[model samples]
Target: MRSRLHSPTVRLRRLAAELRRHREANGWSVSETAGRLGWRSPKVSKIENGESRRLSADDLDKLLNLYGVEERGEREALHRLAKEATVQGWWANYRDAFGSRALPDFETEASAIRTYEALVVPGLLQTPEYAEAVFKGAGLTDDAVSIRRLVQARMERQHILFRPPAPHLWAVIDEAALRRVIGGREVMRDQLQHLVNMAGHHNVDLQVLPFSSGSHPALSGDFTLLEFQDPLDQSIVYVDTASDVRFLEKPDEIERYSLIFGRLQGHALSAAESPVYIRDIMAGLESDDRE
Candidate 1:
């Protein structure tokens, strides 16, 4: 049975895929395999699906034996994967802020992140004040403490961009998001300046999709596509909605989103031109403040 208490981490997912592969290679159906091991079918399903909290060494050994996996090196590798899957990531410490969402966990391991934002700055690029404004705007809660906690969690997530071998971030933001004046004139100004500074980062590529771009492929909404260095950890597309977040991993879905993101980049202002466009908007905000 799937355990809500234990959300699947990437390592766990990788291990699960390996287990499923081995079972398929053995040509044993889930029911047939469970029958051989005296396990209920769902128990085998849980492990293969990465829904189990943790797979004990004995259970893994039994499955390996059942699959005729006799190589000492292969056995040790699978055992190590099982052990690693049970370990919690740093994001687990902020459960109150993130709940069951696993985006941060995956972002920590992504080698490249391509994102399209229709109505706000991407979390990784948001300033503390702007982030606070966003949370407040969402009306997610009235509790000040909760808002602060959420903002803190967002700021912490940005640490990945500064770490060694940082992931490349290519963000395409719609013009409406930039003109929305998210945290009032001053906050918005500072936020724009922050964006200008971040755009200069070697790993960050910021592009603006102007209003003139007109009805684009991603007009449906915002989404992020995360790619990993490891072949086993396939690319995933993440969509965040008001009520729930969806992680799409199917090959077709990945391909579709990838094509959409490429089109977004194409429609957006070039990286060199983006900063100039932003500064002009900042100039307008400043002029309005003067008036």
Candidate 2:
């Protein structure tokens, strides 16, 4: 059990996994470890399973001591991670705008992001007008203030694209996304042009899943696979549905999503050819505007 809603949430899970690993390495069961620390047995399980969000440095130090971790460097690293796990990220400020799982926080820590969008442009690449339209169409709420907050939060999430050590983002967008005019034709025109510009970036790989590729992998829906550089921290697959957001970390699930994403990349246009394909679409949209 894990709460991977935010960056700190993921960090917390990693910390818990580490503690559990160390405890088992030293031949300490949860009950035995809790007895040594003078705590209830369930408390140890809570800490190791990431059910406890109140993980503190002092608590971590005690666990390390009980586990007989003599290495100072290892101790300091775990301590730092513990601190980070509890710290609130920028997205925390917009709690009302987000659902249970914090997508922005996960994006911030991911080293590479692979996404497949079947209907609309991915959030990271959406323009303000396009984003506003998407939100307005969702019928989430009628409150204008709440809508603005959600849009702003999305725009803020895009900042990671320009930050130092930006993550490699590979997005496979369906051709239908281009034809579906959200926020009117002008808004979509600008959005398509934006895609062309973003594709030129070294870290951005944009591909169009052309209509010609029928019955391909990922026909069920859209999903994102996030990869981390650290071996200790495993990759994750995120799926957003009408009801809720799901985070998949089990090895088999991750492998399944990875395979699906791989097949998607195979079916989509090559990154090098995506820009021209987009430009041609833009031309078609322009021609339609004249007629």
Candidate 3:
């Protein structure tokens, strides 16, 4: 589970899932839970969907009991999981300092990540200079030291690429991201090389939507579609904007995003051509005196 390795979000998701299962077992609609528990219909959803503003251990206990799971040991195990799940991970420390949100997931288990980025190099593959330049453009410039630390943190998170039980990552980037000279030519060169190196990894599928491709579904905006291992269960669409992040999980919403991604794949170059594309960009960057 992603929560096991990244954040407490996993446990919260399980809590919601457990509640849902019990409600189904008892043959109760969400309205039934609301009626009996003196909650509004949305409250039932908040708790069962794990979108509650706060995690109440007492509430979880009540739901568990209402579900009629008689085993004390099982209840305790889930309770403990919920408690841990409520705790913050390392990224939480950066909340006030960074204000960057939704870097990880808490619910809707996603076994694979399909990412599309256009303007800048995605955090997973940024060189330090490129990272700083991209952030500076966003007005995140504060202390150079803090900026460097943040960059290091992002690089560390890249370990996920090689971790055990790794998620299959399909990263589709645009040619403009490569052609754009971020942090001057030097940083762009290093960035291109990193892309080449990362593409060699078996777990990663890197493809470039070359500028030659006239238009594609992902052209409107960039979003990631995360697919879980299970069926009709955990899946989400993550869309990041300058000021807010949105997570979409409805079946229709996910289907639309999936279709968009499928169309993008059809227009983009294959993974096998990724390295060649990178090298071509690198050569162009090197010729510039600024590099």
- TM-score leader: 2
**How many backbone collisions does model 3 have?**
1
For model 2, residues 1-291, the per-residue Cα lDDT tens digits are: 222234787787788889999999998899999999999999899998888888777778889998888899988888877877777888878788876568887888788999999999999999999999999999988788888999999998898889877889999999998889899989999999999999999999999999999889888999999997667678889999998889898999999999999999999999998889999998998999899
lDDT of 1 by residue, 187-223 (tens): 9999999999999999999999999999899989999
Which parts of model 3 have CA positions greater than 4 angstroms off? 1-6, 34-43, 53-58, 71-77, 97-100, 106-110, 230-233, 289-291
Better of 1 and 2 by TM-score: 2
Candidates in order have lDDT scores of: 0.89, 0.88, 0.76
Q: Report the C-alpha lDDT of model 3 over 1-291, residue by residue, as the tens digit.
A: 223363466566666787788899999999998888777889889877778736677877777778788898988877876776766666565464435444554322356888899987777777777888776666766777777777766665566667776777898899888898877777778888998998998878999999899878887788888776645246778888877888887889989998888888889999998889889888877766655
List the pairs of residues colliding in candidate 3.
Answer: 9-106
Task: Supply the TM-score for candidate 1.
Answer: 0.92
- Off-target runs (Cα >4 Å) in candidate 2 are 1-6
Best by lDDT: 1
The TM-scores of all predictions, comma-separated, are: 0.92, 0.94, 0.86
Shift of residue 215 alpha carbon in model 2, Å: 0.4
TM-score of predicted structure 3: 0.86
C-alpha displacement of 265 in model 1, angstroms?
1.2
RMSD of each: 3.4, 3.0, 3.3
